[model samples]
Target chain A: MTAYSATVTVRLKEGVLDPEAETTQRALERLGFELDSLSSADQFEIELDADSEERARERVTEMTERLLANPTLHDYEVSLQQR
Target chain B: MTAYSATVTVRLKEGVLDPEAETTQRALERLGFELDSLSSADQFEIELDADSEERARERVTEMTERLLANPTLHDYEVSLQQR
Candidate 1:
């Protein structure tokens, strides 16, 4: 098996209410920065062993579907690199 | 001022214990994936009005310093783009 690095970024689907992002947006505005909208996401980096870059991405995708992301509220993207 | 977009990524500093990452790592392992380390971060995207990209970046950096990131436990990166 070859070593690989993977990134999984999970974000709330458009239209979902993101309270934390809203809070931060308010705080930023309060601090006098003019902004339109703010959104937040979770990013995860994983180092692992996989046979190829495609396989690594597939594994990470499965992991995201199974554990890292909430299917109902989140949409995720995975990137992989051979190490 | 023109429209701009900024991305702020906040991550735990090296040596800080991230319980959530640890928990996810363990779950991945339990599912039979062999891995080295796992880390997680929060990414924020903001839309705003700025005179220039540099000015937008400056504002986001200030936001990171003041609230987006906890300096003692986190490190953050900011990216800005003109819209």
Candidate 2:
């Protein structure tokens, strides 16, 4: 089996209410960082032991869509790296 | 300038208290997933427009360390992808 790592990122879609993001943006502005917009985000680093890269990618994608993310209000992307 | 996207994942080190992870694990178990361990996690998808890939990577890494993550209690890895 090959060892692979998957990074999955989930972020709120535009037009979504994200109090956390708003507060963070305000804090950044106070810290003197110029910013346009901020979005609430989350990510996962999942280690997978699978037969091949293709299999790992497929399984991780399935996991992200099925369990790791909420499809309604969140969008996610998955990237696989061999270890 | 090159357009790049960064994905940063922050997770608590092992032995840290993760109430959110625990609750999520329990819910997953109820949904019939066999999980051995669960870790609290978060991620950011940052878009960067920089002069070079190296510059973008450096800036993103700095941002992750200085602002995006709390290094004492969390560890993060940043990956850059061309956009």
Candidate 3:
């Protein structure tokens, strides 16, 4: 089996209530930083031993879609690389 | 000023006790996933308008070091892109 690394980014889609993002934006403004818009996001990095890079990508994608991300409110993307 | 987007990933440094990572590793093992090691991590994406990309990077790095991450147990990396 090949060793693989995958990074998954999960974020609330546009127009979602992101209190953390809101708070950060306000805080930045207070610090005199200008921002047009802000959104809150999270990421996960998983290391896996799989048959191939393709297999690792497929599995990570399935995991994100099925468990790690909320489809209705969150969008996710997975990137897999051979290690 | 340039509009910029920054992503900061915070993770427990090596040798640190990471309960979340431990739990995830066990869960993956239960599901028959082959993982050599697992690390718990979190990501934050910040959008900022600053005088330049350099300024945004500097500010975000400061935020991560000062408030967003625990220096003793956590390490963070920041990436900035012009928007």
lDDT of 1: 0.90
What docking tier does model 2 reach? acceptable
lDDT by residue for model 1 (B16-70), tens: 9999999989998999877898999999999988888888888888888988999
Interface RMSD of each: 0.8, 3.5, 2.4
Candidate 3, residues B1-83, lDDT tens digits: the string is 77888888888888889787678667766776666766657777777779877888888888777666889989888988887
Q: Which is the better candidate, 1 or 2, if ranked by DockQ?
A: 1
Docking model 3 quality class: medium
lDDT (Cα, tens digit) per residue for candidate 2, span B1-83? 87787777777866778888677657756775443444547766667677888987887777767787888888888888888
- All candidates in order of DockQ, best leading: 1, 3, 2
lDDT of 2 by residue, A13-74 (tens): 76778888777667766776443444557766667678888987887677667777878888
Runs with alpha carbons beyond 4 Å of true place in candidate 2: A1-8, A34-38, A45-68, A77-83
DockQ of 2: 0.29
Best by lDDT: 1
TM-score of each model, paired residue for residue: 0.96, 0.68, 0.85
Cα error, candidate 1, residue B55 (Å)? 0.6
Q: Residue A72 deviation, candidate 2, in Å?
A: 2.6
